[model samples]
Structures are given as structure tokens and as C-alpha cells.
Target chain A: MSFQPVKFYQTGTFTVGNRLLPPEERSVQAQTKRFNSINSGHRACQGCGEALGARYAVDAAMEAANGQLICANATGCLEVFSTPYPETSWQVPWIHSLFGNTAAVATGIAAALKVKQLKGERRDIRVVAQGGDGGTTDIGFGCLSGMFERNDDVLYICYDNGGYMNTGIQRSSATPPAARTATTLAVGDEPGNLFGQGKFVPAIAMAHEIPYVATATVADLRDLEAKVRRAMAIRGARYLHILVPCPLGWGTASHETIRIARLAKETGIFPVFEAEHGELKSVLAIRRPLPVEDYLKPQKRYAHLFAPKARLEVIARLQQLADRNIRRYGLLEGN
Target chain B: MLKQIEGSRAVAEAVALCRPEVICAYPISPQTHIVEALGEFVKDGTLAPCEFINVESEFAAMSVAIGSSAAGARTYTATASQGLLFMAEAVYNASGLGLPIVMTVANRAIGAPINIWNDHSDALSQRDSGWLQIFAETNQEALDLHIQAFRLAEELSLPIMVCMDGFILTHAYERVDMPTQAQVDAYLPKYEPRQVLDPAEPVSIGAMVGPEAFMEVRYLAHAKQMEALKLIPGYAAEFREVFGRDSGGLTHTYKADDAETMVVAMGSLLGTIKDVIDEMRAAGHKIGVLGITLFRPFPIAQVREALHGAQRVVVLEKSLAVGLGGILATNVRMALSALPIDVYTVVAGIGGRPITMRSLHALFREAERDDIDPVTFLDLNHDVVDKQLARERSTRRSGPAAEAILRDIGVVAAKVAQEVR
Candidate 1:
């Protein structure tokens, strides 16, 4: 619900959310009164998408929950950066357990709340489990699946940077094919990551058939914020997997993080869509989508393909993969 | 109500009395019955207003407990052997964050050979993991200790592991004086967590502390466990007042006042040790049995006071440090290092091996004459071991030693490599 239709003066100037919009219409991020859940003065990298995503998601959750949200964070870039011993960046009640137990911890929090609420206590306290790609799609998969299957009252948000970015940018099952990570080096015939290795976990979440599942990216902060708010609005097992770009890990310019993520959604590689009870609700339509090479060419992780050998064949295969996702999800409107 | 029941079922009943808000568990042998009974209780509405989560793994089990405990709910779970190790990281996380979650560790052997029977190796392996560790000597203690465990954990804001002998106490049918919920409620107060995950009074938990605060953070954890030493006996005193029974404490000594030699042990094995000590004392032997109910806090002061005039102390533990000697013996030696007593360690009941009364008789006789080795494996088949040692010395590529020994004894098939085993 944009204020663009009603107010013509603040059109491009009030790009997303601003003072021009009504208080109810403005996002939590738009208002200066928003609780900075993951506050400033943390050691997040320059233009870190996870940092941005966490801020947007947690603030939106806090707003939707009416300031009754606690977080369980997995050990990754977010946990490590936000808390470094004597100082902490977390403004809300937060917990950082082991690398992969965040989902279960969040489930436990929900259980505690349920037990307390059943006894006629306040029932508004909600729980969120947040993790990077490694913690979600790989190590924490079983717990996440269990949480979804149990329909635990939790909103699990996975900030997918496509690899084990926290552990020095290694290959995770979430790492896309033909992506160069430390473990999946660009030194082989099928250079970077081998095709058919990585997993698409949002579909896996849908297979469990929980309440809500959606995908958003850091490029569209408004969309990410909206999905988080919507997920928080639901009662049971909601998953919102946001594709966050890691500037350092992806070998892209710090400012290119949003641009890269935008390209990822536009190219139909990481399908921006929502599903409720395993049925597709809608897709964030891909507008004027370019080829996969247009998305891949910016990062140094894919510099090998551009120089000495313009591996058009590899780019073509990647395009085919994106095309497949587009066809499967009907990502282009009216398709 | 006193009734004969399986130790696991008894423990389940005792836990039910504590009125936990969240109970999560994964199925591991010997531990299965406890959770299964609790599951039935939840289903039947006997344990009402509780969340019984059948978690996927031991890791998730502890993780769930951590969350509930942090959210100020009395939480619980159970595991044995590999399951304990599987949740080892979360185990540390629970205590590190000082969540008052009580867990039952059905003591089972950790394995490469994968033994499922009773042993203290699993519980003892987590000694340094920052949880308060206690052992049970009988089904009654197993039942009573769990009730106290919840209070002790909540009071201290630390996780507690109540280790009971698996299959021995867990599977064995024994009479237990199970406390009523009224008694438990009157004794144990509502869980008021020292720190909780509440939106009204929000505080960051499980923060990533770096070097500056990491050591201090660990020191505080250590300090809390040390505080358990005083609170354990204090709780036991209050428990005796409430229930009219002598159950939990730092240590329990039987006929140890005027004894010259004393046997020190933990868990259900202490019952067997006490029985032999009783027979020996009746026959004019100056020996006694000291059962350690609280092991992780290691009861240094009480241990010293218990063995004050004793000339000799025998430390019998079921778990070994592998390459090093007895696990309990190491701690006992350190606890008694200030004294002039001679401490002997006899590693026993490994992989559920039966430590018979006959072996205890011979060992005590040898201990009486001062003929026992400094470190002895009780009733070990020395012939098979010596042969295996020689076979290993005579060759470079000696096969799997356990299988080799089994083959020699005709237990393993001749072509053991091809056998299913």
C-alpha cells in the first residue's frame, strides 16, 4: 500500500516509506520511532546484506508483534558480528545458541509461550529464528523441518547469501551452481560449484506443507519487510527465506549488493514467490528479465568465466537453470 | 505412594510431580521408557498444560529445553551415550546461558563398538561441560533426585543432569516412594528464572562473548557449579524436612566412621559395593562404603570429611579416561590429594560387563592385604588381553583387536571380515 496514488508530490522522493505516508501505512523502518533491534555499532561488513536484512526483518517483526518478539540466532555472520564479548548490538531480547539449533530454540520459546498462555498469561510474545544459508539449508535443516512439521508458532527467517559466507565463503548446499567459493574453487572443468549439488530449500519447506512460505531479497527492502510482517501475523510455522548478498563473499562491490540481489530476482534464478500450504499464492513478477550472464558478470567469484575464456557455454547452462525456475514458478506475470 | 515400578517409569512419575512446562526428548535405548511414559502422561492429560515435544535428535532436544528454560519455563529431556555426545554442544550452550533445565542421563556406554547397556561413561564424559552432574545409587534415589534436581537447577540457574544406571535402574523393577505433586509443589517453588527471555523485561541471552569476557563468563559458570556444592546439601536438608526421607546429598557414607579402609564410588554400583562392605564389616573387617550422590561438584570437603580417619580409599568407577585410568578416580585423587590416604582405582563394569559380588569379594580381600595394583581392571581376562598384546607386538598390521580376541575365543566367526557381526 504505497502513498504514491494519493500524494503526487512525494512520488520518487518518498521511494518506499517516508513521513509523507500515513503512520499506519508507513513501515517500521520508515518511522524514526522503530526499535532498532539490531542496533548500530556492530562489526558488520560494509554494505552487508545480512545486516540490512536482519534490521528490516526484526524491526518489522517487532512492530507486527507489538514489541513482543524475542530472537534465537544461529552462529554465523549475524551472531558473531552483533555480539563480540563485552559489547552487543542486539536491542531486543536475543539468544545465540550453537551453529544449527536456532530453529529448535525458537520452537522451544514458542512452546514455553504456549504453555504459559494456556495458563491464562499474556499470549502475544512471538519468537523468530534467524540464520545464514549454512545454518538454515545445511546444518540446521533437520531442526527447521521439525519446527515446520510440528507447526510450532515461530517465524523462521533464513538470510541466504548462497554459501557458508561466515566461515570464509566456502561452498554450502545453498551455494548456487557455477558459483566460486573457497571449497568450490574456479579451477575445474565444471568450474566453481558443480551443477546439481545445491538445494532449493523454500520448495523443501513447502513440501512440509506448513502455514506460510515466501522468498524475498534485500534489493526490495519493502517486500522483505512486508513478508516478515505477514509471516509474523500468521499463527504457526511460517518461513521467509530472503536472498541476502554478501559483498565480501560474492566478490562484488559493497554498493552492488542490492543491485546483484535485484538481478538475481529479475533473472528468475532465485524465484521471489510466496506459497501457502504448498500451493503457490503469487510471484513477485520478473520485469524485463535479462540473461543469467548479466547477473553473474559483476562478481569476481565469476571473473574466471569472463577472462581468458568467455565460457558462454557455462553462462548458457546457468540461463537454462534460471529459465527452468521461471517456467516452474510462472515468475513472469501473465505467463 | 510406594510401588514397585521400572526405574524409568518411576523417574517419569517423579518428573511429572515437578510440573515441568516443556518436556522434549529423543529415543535412545534405556532412556526410551522414561520419555515414552512422559509421552503417555501428556497424551492422557495427566501432565496437563505442558508441551511434550518428540524432538528429532538429542541436539534438538537440548535446544528446545534451552529455549523453554530461557523463556522461564521448567524444561526437561533425557538421553544416553551417543545421544549425550550428539547434544554435547547444546548441552554446553544450556549451562553457558544458565538455563534451569533438568535432564536425565540414563547412564550408558559410549561406543565405537556401540554398547547399549548401563555404564557411567556417557554422563561422566560431560563432566567439564558446565552442567551440574549427579548420580543415583538406586531406583528410589533416581526418583527422589529428579525432584530435587528441578529445585537445585532453578535455584542455581544452571542445568542439571541426573544420571541413573541404564537398564540396571531404568529397566529394573524396584519399589520407590514416589512423592505426590502436592509435596513437590509445597517443597519446590514456581520456577522464577534468574534471567528470562521476556519482552516486558528483555535482556540479551547467549551473547557471543569474546576474549575479554569469555574467561570471566566461563569463570562465572564454574562459580555457579561450585555454588551447587553448598546448595546440593542445603536442598537435601530441606528435602528431608519436606519428604521425611534421607535421599539426596553431596555424599552418603555407610559404616564409614571408624573404618580403616573405605570404598568410594558413584551410581548404582555403590549399592553392590555397600553390600560387600556390609558382609565384610559383619565378619570383623574394618571397611566401609562412601557413595557420591553429587559428582560434578565433586564434593571435595564432604569427601575429605567422610574419609577422615581412613587409611586407604578404593575408587571404583565404570568409566575410564582411555590411556589414562579411572574417570572418577582422577577426580577423587584430586579431591583427596591433600590427605595421606592411599587411593586405588579399579575401573569396572565397562560396556555393561557384570561386576559380580564374587569379584568384589576378591578385590576387597586383595585391597585388605594391600596386594591390589595401583590401577586394576576388575576381573579382566588377562590371558586374552596378554595374547592380543603379544599378537600386536609380533605383527604390524594387527586386525581390529576386539574382533581378533573374539575370533580367538570362537565368539567371532573364523572369517570375521565376511561375517555380519
Candidate 2:
């Protein structure tokens, strides 16, 4: 609750409307000269949350570094869509390495920047690596953990779209429970994704306790941009796990991508919090939280549950999980 | 200055003189001393202003190198057998991105039975990985090739892997004429990156080239390697002009001018082949040794010119292609295709098995008599191989051949397959 309600406007509203705030207090993206790091003309699907997430993240990083930013992108939707063959959407110095080594590659860039700075070749250049959930949670996990353990000067942003959306919506380790995917069908005894599997990477990232860790979503652009800027302000290893709703993978309407992401946070299923050196600092508390079904009902990944006469027990279990997260992180404390 | 130093120390000194800015390291057996020596240099302020990163895995080591190299720093790393396999994907990406990073691959046997000995299988597996592969025949050459590798890689904008025999060269101490810092500085200029990640004027590196231009992109990589074939010898000559020594070349010949038979090999094993050749020469036999320093970019023209007219060529290597014969033999035959010489493929020194000079002397005599098999597995235990084959043929489920062989040999207290990962 430390973030003040901008008093000039309806401060409690969750929309990023055009408002004339003071220059210092205004968002980085409010600037007409903000680097369109992920520019237009990319082939991302309509309402691609990852595209928005990357734009906000890299732009904020660029602003924080005073336009001295170099990005390493993994081979996922962002890389494939942004730089399709001859055309690239990135307006900054960006490199697309293998899918699973973005964190390590960014570490290398940071190492080089430090060396060059010592040699008086370059100055104040920061690095950022972006990837999908599959690359971040599974394939690139080891390298990410290595970066964290070494306190590599990088801000690794994982755009979690739940599944491997770019590669045909397969079941990644970040896929939610009781959700259908190409690999996790809706036909097993429990159906969809198994209930008791997968990992919460942001929590594990906090366990490393390097410097800074946070979770944001595309639903909250100002918050996402703020978190990115906050992370860029720090010096050591930083992790920002962003929940980006995939309209294609989650089987939701293109217009509902932001709504679904907002519902995800309001349901208390995805906690929005920040940590520094393994200590919980601040949280975006849920105001008038809704049940998990309000979030899950619109997504077609959970369609089988409703069609087969309402899997009430599974929905109840999901609600309990969200409730537990709320209690643990104090999501509804002030509200 | 000729100093009696261990081979690993020699390599470290040479690498330090080159002034690498970022050195990523991970400890795998037998390759530890080289990285450890570099770490000490970074620690004691000898190699100043270097980031000595102790990465978690070989994957991280190469990943860090890919990042640093792309960022326009002189990057270096080292690994061996299993460590090589662990970082295989990043290994390919390093070259595919065209980062001029230098790596030292201490040659070692890859596992199944899990042995950490000298072999070419590890390096040979990465032959098509777009790296300039260079082998060294002696500790002095091992030290010299690393200095040459950095120059060669940076010149071509491709990674160069400098391979020396694991325990044979890495752990062995010998008298090496170590170059002074002044001589090395005179030989190698400050690394000028061909492409870099700069904010002021940025270019997207490692772009995802689709089917429209993937083939052309790959062909250009081949063209760069072809460019290195010319640059390698020129750098060696420059190195000689500056250092006052002869160390690296595509190929080196020892008395092969009028020989009827020439033994061809790479790495420190050429030492043994040359010794055997000298002995045969003194015995009134017209035999010689042809050592291949540049294994990749195969030095086809030089290989053809040196051994084209020889009557018999013995291709001695330490790796096999499982069902097929020696990898080096296949390459040598490909190089000397026009000639109808009897190319005998000797598969030796697998899993760090000893290759004695006495055995080589006898083998060379056998080659002279034309009484050798086309493919010879040197020092193979027929009794053990036969027992394993027999058991597999007798039963549908032969429990595990490596362990069965180990049991049949009555061996205990050996390194298990624990290192397979």
C-alpha cells in the first residue's frame, strides 16, 4: 500500500487512462519519446499478452538505464514474432540466442559491460533477457538459477502464458491445474493438468535471495512498468515473473485477454508481490476478491469442466489454493 | 625463455598474455588445473581486469561465453569429455552466432563405461559444429596453439577449439619455451570485434533466419571457415616472425619427402608416431610421419600435396564411429581420394588406454610388410570382447555389456558409470 493513489484522478481505478501527471511521477511509457522497444509490424496474434509484456518491460528497462539497454531474447513467441526473418520489431540492441540460455547470455553481456566499463569502453549499460514460461520455468531454469546464485547483473523477465503457446500450446511446467493443453488432454481420471504438479518460479526465485524479485501481469501495465523500473534500479540478479494471458493458448476471446489477466489477480490465484533479499516487501492487495471460477470459466482450457456438468470439486480445490495464497501473502489484508 | 612447466601452466600463461577479459570456468576432471591456474591469475592480480566466473555447469560456462563474446569481450573457457557433451547445444550456438570465443578442450574419452582418459571422440563429435578445430602435438605446441586460436577466431569471427590430450598434455610437465609478454603483445593485437552489442549503433545478432535464407546463412558460415584455411597459416607465419618459433600450421611434415609410407595422426600421439617413424627410417625403411594440426577445414590441399603419392598411409586415431571405423581415417581418405594408396585405419588409445612406442614400432613394421588389417583396434582384448559378444548372442536380454565385461575381467574398485550425466 506504499504506492500512493495519484490524487488528481480516480486513483483506485485499474485503467491506465491518459492523465496529465507531473513529469517525475508519470509512467515512462507516457513519454512521447519512450523507446518503442517492441515496435509495431510484428506477427503476434491479436491481443498477445507477451507482446505487451515485453514492450512494457524493455521500454522501462531502457528508460531506467537512460537508453543504454541491450536485450537477449529467447526463442519463443517474442523472438519468433518480433524478428521474423528479415524484419525485427525491436528498436534497441537485441540479440536472440537459443531458447534456454537467455539468462546466461545476459550474464555474459553484463560481464562484458563490466569489463568494458573497467576499460573505459562503455558505461551504465544494463542487460535484460525475456522468454516465455516454457523457456523460463523448464529449459532455462538451470541457467536462470545459476545467474541468480552468482548474482549476475540481469533482470530476467518471464512472460508466463501458462503453456508453451508458441509451440502449439503444449503443457509447460507453468500450466495451471485442471487445464487442457496439447500434452495434457482433458480425458484423464482427474482431467486437464494434474492438480499436484508444476512449480511457482517467482517464489523459488525469492528463495535464491539475490537482490530483487517480483510478480506482475499484463493486466497492470503501470505496475508492470513500475516493477521493471524498480528492478532496473537494483544492481544484482533480479527476477520478474509476469502472468500474461494467452488468448490462443487459454482459449479465451482476444478482447478478454486483459480482463482474464485481471480476473486472475482478483481471484487471488496469482499473487502480486515484491521481495528483496528474500524478504516480502510490498503487495498489490486484492480488493473484493472473486472466486477462481470467475477467472477459469471464460478460458476454454477449462471448458471440459463446465460441459461435463460442472466439476465442482475441482473448482473448490482451485478456490482453496487461491485462498491459501491470499492468506499467505496477505492479499486482502487492508481491503 | 625455456622454462620447465606443466602443460596446464603453459596454457594459462599463454592465455594470460593474450589478455582475455572474461574467463568462464566449470570444473570437470583432468581439465581442472588449466582453469584453476587461470583463476589464480585473476585472483592474484596477475591477469588484471578479468571476470573469472565460476559457472554452475558446462552449459552455463558456454552460455556465459556466448553472451560475453557477443558483447565484444575476449571470452575464454575450457572443458573435457562429459563436460563437452553437457554443453553440446550451447557449443553449436557459440559458432552459429559467429562469436570469436576461444575454448580449450582437453581431449578425454567419453563414457558408457565412464572412463576419463585421452581420446579424440569428444572433439570429433563436434567436428561439424562450425568451430576451427586445432590439435597440438606437444606441450609447447599446446601452449602456442591457444595463443594462435584467439587470433584465428577473432580474425574469422568464428570460435576456435584448441584441443590438447587430457592427462597426457594437461598433467605432464616438460620444458617449454614460454613467450614473453612483449613478444605475445607484438604477435597479437588487441581484439577488435567484428560485430558487437552496442547501444549507440546496435545490430541484432543471432537473428532467427527462416527457411528463406537459412541455407545461405549456413553457406556463409562455411565460407568463413574456408577463409580461415587461408588465415591460419598466415597467422602462424606472423606468429613465427614475431615469436621466433615454429609452432602452429595446418600440417607439419617430418621427413616425408621421399617416403613410401607415412603415419598420419593428431595431438600429442604424433610424438609417438614420429618416434616410430625415425626408428623405421634409421632401419633403412623409407617411412615418415605427417602430423595434421588443423583437423577441421581439413587442410585438404595441404594433405593432398604432402601424402598424395605415398604408397601406404597409416591413419592412426583414438576414436571410432561405433559400427564404422576411425573418423580421422574417413577424413584422410576423403582428402587423399585420387591416390590408390592402402590407407590402414588404426583405432587406438580409447578410454585412456596406453599406446606404447614398442607396440607402434611393431605396428609400423607390420604396415611395411603389408600384413595389417584394413581396420585395426589396437590393444583390444579379444577375450573380453568375445565373451561379451557371446553372452549377448546366447541370450535375448544380456544384462549390460559394460558391466559384464568388467565382471568378466574380474575388475573391482574402478570408476563406475556415475559420471554418465
Candidate 3:
């Protein structure tokens, strides 16, 4: 301990108290007029990943579009939590569409904007649709693909926190291997979320060869915001998959939200990269690739993989998967 | 001016006349003609300043409507049967998010036996989706309802579904007093969204809500539906003054005065029920009819007052409650429970089976029967029982007789037991 002083100071200790943290240092969501793009008061869990992802992503999109962003949210945790009955936490123009339909909704919004422009309204509006992995990769997959094929002027974002954190933390196609969810339990030989299952939506998105495609994590605030700014610069069906860790569902510390997200990327399990039309443009390379177990041990979802000789086979398989991703995307130098 | 028009075409023409900013839809049976017409209008520039989005599926159709509506654009769409089921999640979202989207529900029965016909089951399934649902009795009503639906939806900032009987209304041709563009302009004001996508005022529309505030938000939506009771009449009165035509705005009262028995119905079935009522009255049966145009708001007060004098009320519905009874009958029971009215429920026309004039006469006869149950599932094939008994006995004792019988019978024989219940 470097005598950094066991400083036991409670900085403002409450909701609006963040004001004491100098305006710049305050959390983006803590600001009074901070876009509130994902405004206050929703039905999200104590630490829902989708909630954090929406706030970070939408606020960033709002900033990119100069606050002229219209969002189409697929029916899921975000939609349920935000607009329950009569009241809503959304401060911006937001639409809650069916699950598996955000891509088409955004496409329509873009078409409407084009019409506005033809009518000489000169509205430089941007469209964004959001959904969880289940909605993006499964139910709404056809619509999403259609949007990509049509090159609709919309930026479709998927907030992938592994599985469907809503509806009781069920397993989704995006759920990783050896992760135990409500539907995918750690039973059977080679238990938990089975290997050779799930989808790499970002890779699939890149294959469409649209203008922009990126994979991000909530760990890096500035990076996430910057990517949103970059995605808005293009005008076609763009894709952004954000890895937002759900503390409540993932059984992690609420305060460890950013740290866990960082470890996910650093472990090479969830590669952070950008692509344009099937070609990898840039990668947020890990400085020092850590063992996959270092990341898995922190979350309780992977707790079962840790018992009995540390399940080196499972850890090795995960590391092999990560290594494959690194090699495939040239996630580091010397590709 | 009256012109020959299919129910779907009339709905399409009315939607064009309404001049919505965004029209998003997916093709499904029965509703396909409606969306196709709108798409043609968009392609030909007849529907100017509109974005016609051909979505991937019905789910996407509703999804796109939600987005366009939130973007401060007047949005419209149409779907039916399986398409409606596919879009159910989006339907609930549009209402929950409070985006005033207007959708045309070409009501049809959901299928497992694979059906495509006229029924209220499709639209009735979404009765509690927080949308303002209006049932049309005719093609003319279907057209007029589309225009009125936009006004009502915008007024409450709630999504609205204009339901028309599949094939019965969508495929049938009828003469309708189609409103002129100018007339519609005067009646249905240009959609100016109260909450819009603006950069200067930067606000989020669908932010995640926690458990602490979720229930309150739903309660507010429920409160809005209740508030619509007052709004429907006010808007209807205004629409009547402007266009000089104001039918299909809400519940329609037929010959309810001094009647001992009244038949309450919805959608196209009303026309048949009315004819039956007239014949019953001619035969000194003391019968009347009450047609429900607005189903979602339930029209509690209006229904109570309409049936106040009636001793017995028979509700003719196209959708069944499965384990319960008739959906419309259940609402009627809840509405008039305080009064001493004997309510009878008749479920018919499911899976688009035609509710003929003769069938309705039989319903009235059943209603007058001394031993008639309060809830009766009509159009039920009585032959299913025999088929079921034979199948059950055969399956229980799988001997040579059972094998021989199975060989003689068709695929229907296998499901006879299930069909019995």
C-alpha cells in the first residue's frame, strides 16, 4: 500500500450528489443535462447490462448526430424496463418495436428521413435500432439481413451481454461456451453452455460488406463514444456489437462493471475490432493477453468451470477459441 | 361519391387520403391486398411525402411503424392472422412506448389446422395491448375507421388498430363514400407529434426503467385508454362536423328501445345479426341488436346504458375464449354485471367460417331456448364426438378390430380424440 491514504471519503454519496465530482470527471449518466439520452426512471434490474449499454450507446449516438437521433428499440429488457405502462425514462424520440425487428424499424426511419430531405426539410437525422443478442441473431435475423442487403441508411447496434439477460437470464445463441444460464445449465459431461454453439454476429455483420462494422465493450468509455461518432459518419447499414456485462445476471460485483468488461476484451475471448466491407480495418489489440481463466473466474456464470482441477480442458478450449479469434482478425500485430 | 371498392382497397385509399408520413408493412394473406395497394400508391407518387417500407415480415412491419412514429412521423401499417401473431411483441411495444401508430388489422383466425378466413380472434387477441382498437362493420366503415383511427391515435398518443373481418370485408366489394383529400385534410389534421426527434431539445424516448417505476408506467397507459372514452365522442363530433360523415367512430345503437332480448355483435357479423333481429321482431320475438364498433375501450358506460332496458342480452362473437367462452361475452358480462340482465355468449365464425344469415337465426333460437347455457360455442361440428369415441376405444384396445378400423379411416381418425374436447 503506497500510503495513498486509506481515504474513506464518500463523494456526494447519492444520485444527484455526483455534482461534487467536477463537471468533467462526473459519470456521463450523472450529468443533469447529460443527453439523458437514456433518461431516468426505468424498470431495469439493479445492474442490468442492456440498460448501461443503451445509455452509453444512445447518448453517444445523440452526440454524434448532434442530438438528432431517432432510436428503434426491439422488444426486450430495454423496451420493457423503459416503457412499462404510461411513463417512460426515454427523453429522446424513441420507439419500442417487436423483438427481432429493430433493424427494419431503423430502415423505415431512415426512409422517412430521406423523404423529408426530398421535401426540402433538410433534416440531417440519423437512425439507430437496438436489441439483445437473441433479437439480433435469431428472431429478427431475416429483417437485419434484409436491411444489410438493402444498405438502408441506418446504424443497427446489438448490445450483447452474452445471453438474454431479461426474461430470467435465459440462454441465447450468443451465449458463450461453458457459461451456465437458466436454460443452459452446467450439467452433463462437458456441461454448461456447449462448445461449437452460438454465433459471432460481428463477424457475420462484417461479411455483409456494409460501410462500417465494429465490436466494442462498455469498459472503454471514450472508445465506445468515438466508435459511435465514426459509425454516424457513414450512411448505410452499419453494425455495432457492444459487450455490456450484466452484474446482476452475470453474478459479478456491481462496481466491477467497467473492470469486468475490460478483462473480457483483454483476455482475447471477446476481440475488440472494426471492419469495413469484410476487411478488418483496425483492432483494439490487447497489450498483454491474459489467461482466459483470469476473466472467467471473476463472474459466477463461469464458476462451475473453475472447480475440480480448475477444468484446464475447458479453460484451454476457451483460450483456443480466443486464440482463433485473435488469429482470424489479426487482433494483434504481425498479421 | 360512391365507388366499387374491395375492403382492402378502401382501407388503402383511406390511408392515402389520410396522408401518413410513413407506411411500413409486410405481406400476409388477407392483409396482402391492403399493403400492396398502399405500396402501389407510394411507387406511383400518389401517396406523396410518404416513406413506403417493404419490411421482411409482419414483425418488422410493426417494428418499423414504431420507429417511424417515434421519429415524429404519422405512421400506418396492416397485418392479419399469423402475421399479427408474429408482430404481437411490436404491437405491445408501440402502445407501451406511446407512439401514435395507426395499424389496420384485417382480422382473421389463428390456425394450427391452417386456416385463412374472417374472424375476430386475431384482433381480439391483442385487446389488452394498450392500443385503441376499433372494429368496422362494413367496407365503408373500414375506410372511415382508418381516417378516424389516426385522429384518435394522435389525440391519445396511443397506437390504434382498425380491425376489419378478413375476406368478408377485405375481399368483398362495396360502395363507400370515399372522402376527398381536402375533406380528409379538414377532418384529420396533419400529424404534429407532441414528442419529436429534435436535436435542440435532446431527450431519450425509450430509456430502461427499473421495477420501481415499471408498474406506474403501465398504469398511465391504462389511464389513457380510460381517458379515450371522453376523447372518442369529442373527436367523432368534430369529424362529423367537418366531413358530414361520422359512422364507425364508436359503438352503434340499433333497435334497443323496449326490447326484451338484444343481440350484441361486432365486425361484419353485425349485419347478419341485424337481419336476424328484424326477422325475429317481425315474428313478434321482441328482439333488438347492438353493434360494437370500438372494442378496446370496451365502451362500458355506453354498453350499460344501451342494454339498460333489455332483460336478456346475447353476445355474438367470432372468437372463443377456449377454456372460458366468448371474448365479447366475457366483456358484456363484466360490463352489465351490476344490472339484472341474462347474458348469453355465442362464439362463431372462428377460422373464417362464414356466419350465414341462417346460422344467426339458429343463434337467436338458441338464445330463446329455455335450457340454453349462458355460454355456447357455435359452429361446433357435432360429428366430432362420434369420431372421438371411435378413436379412443380403438386406441385403448389395439386389437385386429382397431387396426382394421384405423386402415379404413383417414388422418382425421388419428386426431378424433383431440377434436372431441
In terms of lDDT, which candidate is strongest? Answer: 2
Better of 2 and 3 by TM-score: 2
**Candidate 2 lDDT, tens digit per residue, B388-415?**
8998899989998888888886734342
For each model, chain A TM-score? 0.94, 0.95, 0.88
Off by over 4 Å in 1: A1-23, A188-190, B393-398, B410-421
Question: Which candidate do you rate higher for lDDT, 2 or 3?
Answer: 2
**CAPRI band for model 3:** acceptable
- Which of the numbered candidates is closest to the native, going by highest TM-score? 2
Among residues 3 or more apart in sequence or in different chains, the pairs in candidate 2 whose N, CA or C atoms overlap within 3 Å are none
For model 2, the DockQ equals 0.81
For model 1, name the residue pairs that clash.
A85-B209, A85-B210
Compared with the true structure, all predictions reach lDDT values of: 0.89, 0.90, 0.81
Report the C-alpha displacement of residue B376, candidate 2, in angstroms: 1.0
Worst 10-residue stretch by lDDT in candidate 3 chain B? B398-407
Q: Per-residue alpha-carbon lDDT of model 3 for B12-68, expressed as tens digits? A: 999999988888878888889998999999999998888888777787788778767
